[model samples]
Target: MRIKFLSIIASFFMVSFVITSCLDNDNEVNYSPDATIRAFELDTIGYGVNYKFTIDQVSRLIYNVDSLPVNADTIINSILIKTLTTASGIVTMKDQNDQDSIVNINDSIDLTKYVNATEKNNFLVLKVWAPNMEVQNEYKVNIRMHTMVPDSLSWGDKPIAENPAGITAQKQKLVTLGDNILLFTQNSDKVYSTTIPAGSPSDRLNYGQSWDSKNADLPEGADVTSIIRFADKLYLLTENKKIYNSNDGLTWTEDNVLTPDGATVTNLITSFSNSDGSNHKNVNGIASVIEKDNKKYFSFAEQKETGWNITTSTEVVPAEFPTNNLSADVYATESGTLNAIVVGNTQGLDSKKDTATVVWASEDGKAWIPMEIPSNNNCPKLVDPSIIHYNDAFYICGKETKDDAKGFQKFYTSPTLLVWKGVDRMFMLPGILPPVKLEGGVIQYPYSEFSFKGKEANYTMVVDRNHYIWMVGGQGIDKIWRGRVNKLGFLIQ
Candidate 1:
């Protein structure tokens, strides 16, 4: 009886042990060998030309895990985020739930501390790891950052063909008349017209037929310096100080109303007219400073029933400027105000070069007052700068000497034309690298000189009615390129 009882006890103990082992096996958590990223999401945010991302905008890095088991002793060894370009510094990532804590699989990570405002075309990469696992898998996520603002300039696929053989192609000027763009050669009455291409408004310009010179009514061999449209007539200013008016580009009428007095008309601009319907005309024309008999004078012309009436103001020359050889480039702003930026060298009391640059502003284009321009370290001395009122601001494009060794072309913008700010180099036109000629007799790539003097003389830029900025024929350069200006005054793409 004692042996039977012992056998029964041993059997009962074995059954109890078997039950305990089964329970333990059933309750055991199966830790996945490989973890999976279910979803990686970034917050949608808009960007601008000069947008600086704040910490809150880029704080969230929401992600979901598929195979990570809850209540399991899964240890995340490290979480790293970096840009694909440098891959140098480890991005500072923190738990979104607890700002001071490190990032974890359960919580989203803050990514604001990692992003930079200056860097563009950037790709962000995230790498996560779980240590001491059987598989020891590393998970990764890649995201691309995009600019919310449209590019200022995007090159088109079509390339403008070279000028027909033997055609005298000098510097070209773009004059926008309604829907068509007229290209006039410097020092020639010949004009060529092009219509804006179909499709996107950002499409490249398409050249049309060249106009007959017989229809363009100007003196033979007259050098066309500047052109402007006022009211219902198109006016052309010649280097010899002659004004020609045309109802249609086909037939021009010489309006010899303004006697240039031997001073060449360098610029022509029309002021904004009063909209009260009280005035018969809404536009006023102003010519650049003209030199006559060794004295500089500002000329004004008004369209009337008979012809354009002219008036000259000798007092327009600022007292600080050299009375002789005074030259300037004039631009009319959207507000109908005229801004004259002195271009040539100014003379001191001793008749030498003056260091100060002068800028004058006028509403009526007759009475002018000097504007205060603050000195900026980034504002370089502009050489023969071209001013255009575009994108709600004034853009001055010219060359500047850097480190006194090399000179490069740059652009500056001013909201009120009183204070100017330089744009970043990344925003400038690309594909302007120095030219290289290949062995096949094909010019590899041609570049323009930073300075617009000597060999680079006649390098010019203009903005059309469509807000498309064009850099046309320069001395020894027949290449034409176009760009767009954003509302924020940034030249893009």
Candidate 2:
């Protein structure tokens, strides 16, 4: 009887141990945080590019939501998307007469609202909301969230709507005006002012040079390509084939600097590639003006050489400037590529056009030799390239042309201009895939557009001290677009 009693106690102890172990395992497996994603489920949607948090169970929400790291109990009291979307929190659209069609912020088709377990794994609802704005029909909208928590941000997602049909192209031109009022002269000669302060449109601003309105005007039959204001002088290249230099914005002196012998195509002297007056010498127009180490640089198309070249000025005068060969493409097309070139003034890099790929250096800015890119990659193929320097790095913007008809904006970054490989910072901006069709023939209205589809060019980038990148379009109208790299990624300013 005593042995039996002892056995019964041992069995009871084993049962208790098993039950305790099972209970502990259950508790561990069901571990929950006071602040799970379910706490204050945030869902940033589009009225514009901003975050919209959906209040969950967290009564006292906490987050440092202004692009910094988010923490607990941080309240996102308000979010203002600097957009046309109304603050009433309702989405809208336009009718045939260009009137508003009201819709709930939670019901628009282009917009989406959702909650995430974290920023990573999220659930999506079928409907969305948008605002009724004119530009809303012109651009595609994308919204994403960034969280302080690791692996809490959303991944690659498409914009709410495909860009609608319209003339989204902005007329962009480079002009030097009084008091540094850089003007983007429209094709119709209508000037769109830039950040350059407005002052008298006098020839004295450019010294004695005349901005001969008719002389440096857009090609008689083409378009106004770009203008550069370097040093005290202003240079303008017209699509109709002319290069005009002016000491002031009003008075202009015409020079066929690139023309072989200054051939008069329709009475307008086209800028020649060489002094011999070669019509086929230069194909494209002069692009951006870059100044490095007290030297002024000009980028343009060298048609005869079948590539692009960069010319530098030892003096401010266009006449005294010595031209050097930059990068030349083996092929050329209207669908041609432009590489953005930025010279490092303090970066101690060399100044060769073809060898400007960062890794290669020419201390004197002339004689260049081939060097290996660290990645052993080929050079980038740029069509209509534009460049800007910022924060010790050169950012290049150009259009990547496919063998097919598709083209889009592409970018690259390097500490030096030489040794720029295909591998660099690459980004595609929000632009139309279809090219805008323009009118041809008479240079007067040569800038005509088709009613249907057209693609836009990548932007010409200019970086300011405030780190804002000012961009102007290539073939379209002159509208200035600003850009910057922000916490939410790249924002078109």
Candidate 3:
């Protein structure tokens, strides 16, 4: 088909040139054979032009290698050529009837009509004339523009692809290790993992490797729910009030940090990182809460060369502090400031008529500070919320118990951890999609947008090294999905 299309245009060029050169020749003078359109341009677009229009002489086509924004299609309807450079030839548009009109740089041209129509020359044709009076032949003009929103979050319909681990468990977590990500699922004291390979953060609908046995197991008393990554090692607290470290996610070893005196390990908070260059002895550590004498306290232990440097906060853990089903992580802001935050449930939220989720921040891991958020209807009861710092903002995803919304609804985002706002439009969850049916079969609504009737268990959202948002597993929905903002997938990012 491509060969046939090119032959037709080639024949047109040959016939047009032959007829003009074989004229009566009353003057017997020479005419220049050059009839090339050197350049063409519209104004700079919103995202700026990453590529310019390339004139392909062999294919007789003029196009932009990279696409313009979606509005560029409409913009071309009345857009004047801001720059049109030819080989000093008179440019004109010829019709089917052979009637022609001169084309000027200021004249608007509609490029969207009959674009991608290769079977015929039914679209507008811009011709360049040689020194002679006759015009030259066919050179199709094609401009490509994006069909999807550049910044809006795009998700797939439903699972037509393999669900990495192949089994849906009641709970799962995503852990990052440099270039790869691990999806860890626990069931009946047996834990499994699937490694997701790393690459560019483009439009990836499905991602994950086959499940492996991992060839490792946890200690008899190690808590699987409290495992966290600290610096280069994975740490978890055991039932003996001893903190254990593991170079790999499996095979734990005893560490120096213990739940001192008679306290038991409550839970692991998060890993705190130091990005401060001035601190020559830049240290990293893990934070946790321990209960002793009926009072819970914040505890942090720094990773040392030989042993661990433990520090327990003197301030008593507040009653409003999140205790269970917590999600936490450390992320750096745009200005290079590091932040460690934890968000979950506190027993007192049921008694309050305001928001249900609580947030706390820490600098050195030991001193915990509550970040105040607006107490309003915008903040829902985000039970088992998974918090992630992505694209410079923090996003919380979980089940909404307040109004009884379905499908893990409402992802709240905040630039500053203190102020959060529910995203009603842009960022949304993957909608439930049904299998495509025959001509007379029925399809479902909420196919690709957020669905309130959909069913998906609470899951973890982890950002990969390349910044792709990876949805690992829901208790009921064992699916691996990778998504990224369209602009973030651009080469500029």
Candidate 4:
């Protein structure tokens, strides 16, 4: 009977122990002190995922490295921030108007008020609290946006620089040597060069550039039209089929560039620009050539350590290939095919008047092909044509063969390098328009589009490393204009 009573007492003690353990588990409390933000998620549809933000836990800062687009302000008021989770606590943002009171941020938070107060800068008063509300941590954020429509190009009232050559002469060529804009003037059958400070219109006006003439030993009658840069030296084909290279802008040296046994290079085409037209240096070029047997053909001028290694193409120059006033550029197609393109004036044998600007292309620099100009999409009869690969397309700018030389500028662009269309709005030139003048005592309205103000025959253009278009026109308007597409000139973008 005593043993039975002891057993019942032991069972009662065991049941009591189980009940005590259940109560302990039910009343458990967390005392973690760490409070942090695990991720700060931005709305993907609006921001487009490119505006990546970096979180600096040490400095307690969250900001984007790249300035947001111009439209960032569109959603600034109701910017959707999908969510901002925390490592701990009930996430809370200090009340914008009353900092003393806090608003619990459930799934999303409204930061527009805070952003406005701090001017888009994230002054993160964001706090993650421990569950007991005893410990807390704070973070700050910053936002940046572009001030203007980045892609729209704007040319401030006047030329960034004018009359850089400081010469009254009307026949010259503009070229760039690194940062310097050099103009080679035609002086008594000999060409002399002068360097001018080249910069944007945003730079100080009338840079008071000194014209340092580099005219010690320049070759006589060097066709400024035929001058092209290859490697580190500037080379020009003279009237007599002689090739001369210059180290300095002046001192000319005769480079015995070997052609085929009986072939002679007539014109130096152009050094190939990169496929994207961003770079046009240290590359090979093309040469329009003729054999001693009176055969017209083209050849390739390969880049070399010292000079060009001329490779004669087996094919003959097409009958329509331009003979003079030519501008050419070699570029790679998307599929990596090398295409050499040339545009110039072509006139019939008995016709004194020049025909429309003609275009020719070659794949291997040997076989030449003419791109047929459609009647519906015909180009102007340009006297002096210049072509360049820019903005994923080719642009051709030149003067018409019409007399007067006023309001005769023509600018055209081609995507497939086939159909040409006149450019407007974006490239319509303000610099090309004439100033309001008196017509029979009545004030005349300025025409919408025109060439640089002059009867200039010699005009040269270059797209600089920074993609600024530097144009120098000779004949009358001996001025230099530096302009760029607004976005291309942005510093921080």
Q: After superposition, how far is residue 96 of candidate 2 from its true place, in Å?
A: 59
User: By TM-score, is 1 or 3 better?
Assistant: 3
- Give the residue spans of candidate 1 off by over 4 A: 1-152, 156-171, 187-189, 197-217, 238-240, 248-250, 259-283, 287-294, 304-311, 314-316, 319-359, 370-383, 399-408, 433-457, 486-493
Per-residue lDDT over 1-493 for candidate 4, one digit per residue giving the tens place of the 0 to 100 score: 0011223434554576568668797764555776776666566424365456667788767666555556566565445555566654345554434333333333344444444334744465666665444677777766655555666554445665555555454455666565555666555333433333566533433332345544446566667777776546777777778778886667788867635566666777665534323332434554556555788667767656676676776666665667765777666667665577888755454344334565777665555677765565656667667787765678787776566544335468888777788875466443743235576777553542223633544677766555666667655555566666665654334
lDDT of candidate 2 at residue 207, scale 0 to 100: 19
In order of lDDT, best first, we have 3, 4, 1, 2
Counting only residues 3 or more apart in sequence or on different chains, how many pairs clash (N, Cα, C under 3 Å) in candidate 1?
5
Off by over 4 Å in 4: 1-41, 45-49, 54-63, 75-77, 82-142, 167-169, 176-182, 188-216, 273-285, 303-309, 313-316, 347-355, 402-410, 430-457, 489-493
133-167: candidate 2 lDDT, tens digit per residue: 11222112222333334212111122221111112
| TM-scores for every predicted model | 0.51, 0.34, 0.70, 0.70
Query: Model 1: which residue pairs collide?
Result: 152-492, 153-492, 153-493, 272-336, 273-282
Q: Clash number for every model?
A: 5, 70, 0, 5
What TM-score does prediction 4 earn?
A: 0.70
Off by over 4 Å in 2: 1-172, 175-188, 196-226, 237-243, 247-250, 254-376, 416-459, 474-479, 486-493
Q: Which residue window of length 10 is worst by lDDT in model 3?
A: 1-10
When summed lDDT is taken over every stretch of 10 residues in candidate 2, the lowest stretch is: 202-211
CA lDDT, every prediction?
0.44, 0.34, 0.64, 0.59
* Deviation from truth (RMSD, Å), model 3: 7.4
Q: Choose the strongest candidate by lDDT.
A: 3
In candidate 4, the residue pairs with backbone N, CA or C atoms under 3 Å apart (3 or more residues apart, or in different chains) clash, namely: 122-141, 122-142, 124-139, 124-140, 170-475
lDDT of 2 at 412: 62
